[model samples]
Target: MAALDMLEREPDLAFSLNGLARALKVTPMALYTYFGSRDDLLQALTERLLSGFVTVVDGDMPAIRRVEAWCFAARRFFLGYPQLLGLLTWEGGNTSVAWFDRSVVLIEALQELGFKDAELSRAIIWIWTSVMGAISEEIRNRTAPHSLSPAQVESLDPRLHKPVRDMLMLAEQPDHFDSFFAYHVERLLDALRAIAKRP
Candidate 1:
């Protein structure tokens, strides 16, 4: 918990046994009593962060709606702990099995809707990527707030790219991000629903 507190306080700080020990006001050797290595400590923290992330939706709900609920829930959960995103990205190949295990409910849900091996894998990847991509955009918007100026949008030729200009204008307002993310999620689920219906 102390490690997580340190991480939340300084999200960019790299994990190290020495650093964590210092933060906790204990000797580095004291950490070794609880963790075998820095990786072990980090993995424990990661598990704590993700332990309660379940994607199970009510069976009474439409299968596609279940999937949509999972996607949105994942986005909201990860957005709450943006630091976990960076840790996961940095760990990459070294990530723990717990990370992949979080998808079991999602995989089962897709299976119920007729997805099989390869298709199921692809669907899982698409759902996760879309959620993560949206979260990344949201984090950027919240932290950096980069948006095109009206003058910049107007500088583009309207005749050639009116829609592009309009999109640029819309991007200027971070308030619309949730609606934009929802629109894409719905479109993606529509495509998945069509595929599920196919024989």
Candidate 2:
């Protein structure tokens, strides 16, 4: 749709039916014929983006690794298209059909290892929340206006909180860590494995 194309080119622009119609070279009222309202259009857009989300993980990989794989996939999808940030129905990745399908894959993987009910629910929340938290922070830090300078960003020490400094040191040197996203997701997966081992 014209609105989607507009967003692709300029993600920061606020979406409006009039703006969409203008992009398509049609009258604003004409948009009503295709979509009932802004919400309807947004829902459609969300689905369109989510359709590309990976739905399956490698069965040969360990369950914990499968969690990492799926979470990373979700992260890549949204962060790749940061413009959808505002149109998203949920704060993180929860508002779309892709979220549901990916959750099932992770949940079933946990179930295969004998987790279910409350234990299962908590695991699902923990895994996806970690994924969403990481991606959301990445979008803001990377795309948000008024970013700190290279000196400001790279010069870390007493100015930043301990954990914050440690976490971000690699951003200044992307090569410092093999991959930041993989690092955190693996950390979360380690914790998840520990949690799963609990009685």
Name the best candidate (by lDDT).
1
lDDT of 2 at 38: 52
RMSD of each: 3.0, 4.6
Tens-digit lDDT string for candidate 1 (102-153)? 8776777789899999999999888878778888887778778665566776
Compute each candidate's TM-score over C-alphas: 0.80, 0.71
> Alpha-carbon error at 160 in model 2, in Å?
7.4
Per-candidate Cα lDDT values, in order, are 0.75, 0.67
20: Cα error in model 2, Å: 3.8
What is the clash count of model 2?
Answer: 0
lDDT for each residue of candidate 2 in 1-199, tens digit (9 for 90 to 100): 5555787787766656577778989887776677886556556657775666775677687777677677777777766666555545544444655446546767777887667898888877777677777787777666552335557655767567455655556576755323767788778867777777788
Span of ten consecutive residues with least summed lDDT in model 1: 84-93
Quick one: RMSD of model 2?
4.6
Model 1 misplaced regions, further than 4 Å: 7-19, 27-30, 89-92, 157-161, 172-175
Q: What local lDDT score does residue 126 receive in model 1, on the 0 to 100 scale?
A: 87
Task: After the best TM-score superposition of candidate 1, give how far the Cα of residue 64 lies from its true spot, in angstroms.
Answer: 1.4
